[model samples]
Target chain A: MSDRDLIIDRYKDLLKTYLKGKSETALYKGQQFSRKLIEQQISPDDVLSDHVSVLHELFPDMSEELKDSFDFLLEVMIGYGFAYREHQSLRTRQRQLESEIEVAASMQQTLLMSDVPTVDGLDIGVKSVPAKKMNGDYFNFVKDHKSVSIAVADIIGKGIPAALCMSMIKYAMDSLPEQRMQPNLLLENLNRVVEQNVHPNMFITMLYGLYDTDLHEFYYAGAGHEPGFFYRASEDRFEDMFAKGLVLGVSRQTRYKEYQLRVNLGDMIILLSDGVTECRTSKGFIERDEIVDLIRAHMHKPAQEVVESVFNELERLQEFELRDDFTLIILKRKV
Target chain B: MNIQSCVEVCNEWDIVSARQLGRNMAKELGFGNVDQARITTAISELARNIYLYAGNGKICIEAAEKMGKRGLKIIATDNGPGIKDIRKVMEDGYTTSGGLGAGLPGVKRLMDEFMIDSVVGSGTEIIATKWLR
Candidate 1:
């Protein structure tokens, strides 16, 4: 017998046993038979139709109203079957897409991974977390004998596209060592690359800075990125280091303005994404001053602890639900 | 021929039903495979926006004709928290939901003509049309 016929026969036998004695064993068998029916891909309509047929065969005088009700239930089951199959297919497709994105997200992590290099005169601490599986924020460090270059970039898109764009930026930065030291020149070159390769609808905001150990100064440039903060230990004040430049991919001829800051002893320079400054809470956004004060409260700690504390405070205010990708880098002059 | 169908947008299933209705209507109107897919996708995004942002809304698809050309029209209406900055939402890469940031702009690009009317306190309405070439 075909599988369908076999399932129907088994179901009919179970029904007969249950009607004969109303035994618990028969009900248990019925449950087991239902599992078989499910495994055999039996439709509810088919089961109902078979049940009505079996009941008529056993009674030979099933009531007309009861038969009509079975027919109505079968009709409803047919509609339910179609919707059930559609939902299953949609669920399968969603699972496939989710797995693909998960794979891509892991690959992004492995490929664009950068080690936070230990500089001789600076204590560096960095943390980046994605609000989703795929991150729109990217940060990298390129270290050499004379300087350590830091780049923080945020894509205007999300998901696989943004992750792919960030990977491209990482590879591009890796291939270019000539423009690594000059912040303005590096951004100008990266902007051209982004303009040429990235989609027209997408753009990126980036901040590139290089700290020269010999001169004890930081040369920084921006491309519509969130401004960083400068903490002067001698003055015991914080200043927002704003730079004027257009976002990448907007224009090929865009020029990034470069600025330099002399790093006094025990001073700190902070680089971050808008996700840090715009951390949303139930009250509203966490203000820049609040973030600065949070940093001040933990300034006595090590660089890593300070970075972690600031992130912890902001994350707590948002109840640990990140609305955007968070990236923060703190470079404190230790030597 | 004039046919109008409206699908309530309350959950993910409603988005699927709205897209299915759009696809069937496009087929009945003799729209080719490409235009049918575009119309279906546009409806899916619009319906999803309603489900995601407005919580519950409705999608209306109708057979349209203008200037002697056959066309299809889609209207998405929502009474939830309306969009505050319509212009900013229309811009590509602008999203409050942390999506790919291509919701409204992507729909506008898919349809030949798109119009959005939104009031912060009241609600939002979007009408999009695509003509058969």
Candidate 2:
């Protein structure tokens, strides 16, 4: 006999023994048989169908109503069987996707690794956190003689695609030497690269800024990115630093406008992604003024501590669960 | 060709049921494999939005006839917190739930006709259609 037939025979014997007497020995044998059935990948509907067939042979005088009830149960089990299979397959796919993403995320971290350069007269702080394993936000700093350049970018997509695009951007930016010092030219060149290489459906928003230590001037440009804040320490007030330009990858001919700000002693310039300003809370999205207030509350701390404090506060407001990638950078003039 | 199927989307199983029903309807309407996949993907996204954001909702797939063309229409309705900013949500790379950020805009790209109406604190309703070519 085939394995299925043997199983059916054993199942019939077990059912007959159990029906004769509701004994503990028969229940134990039935449990053992069930394990075998499970090992054979037999579904519940198949087991019910086998039970009905055995019952028909054992009790030849069974009523049609009783047989019909068994058929009804078998039909219900068939639906249950399909749903169970769908659930199992979906779970398997989810696990596989999650592990693959985890591997990609770690590889991204290794590919885009960079150190925060130490520059005199500038207290710089930066942080980037992803809500998921993969991050769509990117930030990099390049140190030049008597100056430091910062680039904060947000990709319009997520997953492996976003990570690959970011790595490409990292390598592309690393190849340029003089362009890094000029915010507008840097963005224009990067925009052309993205437009030519990346997919049309994807776009990138970037904020590039260069701080000249000797001249105490901060030059910045934006490509449809979120506007940051310039904290005037002398006036004890914050000012909005807005720059308008098209997002990258839209057009190769797009030109970016550069803006300059005089960084006085103790003044601070904050550059961040929309994840900071658009933080959702129980009430709604936290206002820009609230973020300014948060920075003001931590103004007395060091630049690094200030960024950390702001991140912690915002993270708490969201119940320690970030919905999107969060990136923040602060450049404070200490000397 | 009378097709009017409704699936209550409250959990994961409901999403599966809704998307399967959508694919069946699309196949019944003589849609090709590519269109069938697109319709099912759009239905999955809409149903997931209901499950994730609204907590519970309903998806209705129906055969539509407008003018001289025959199409498949999908309607997803939810009485959740509703959308705070419809314009912002439609923009790419904008996600509040940490997904692929391809929630609504992705669905819009898959369907030929899409319309969404939402009011904060009231509810949201979306209607999308893909005509057989």
lDDT of 1 by residue, A1-335 (tens): 88667766787888988999999999998888888776666655557777877887888887889877765566445444433444444456689989988898898888887899988989988888898998889999888888889999999866668888998999888878898888999999999999999899999999999999888989999999999999999999999999899999999999988999999889999999999998999999889999899999999998889999999989999999998889989999988
Model 2 C-alpha lDDT per residue in residues B1-133, reported as the tens digit of each score: 7657899999999999998899888888898544666688789889999999999989999999999899999999999999999998886556776554247866776688999999999899999999987
Instruction: Report how far off residue B8 is in candidate 1 (Å).
Output: 36
lDDT of 2: 0.86
Give the CAPRI class of candidate 2. Answer: incorrect
Candidate 2 chain A lDDT trough over 10 residues, lowest sum: A79-88
| Per-residue accuracy of model 1 over B1-133 as CA lDDT, tens digit each | 7667999999999999998899888888897544566677779889989999999999999989998998899999999899998888876556666544237876776689999999887789999999997
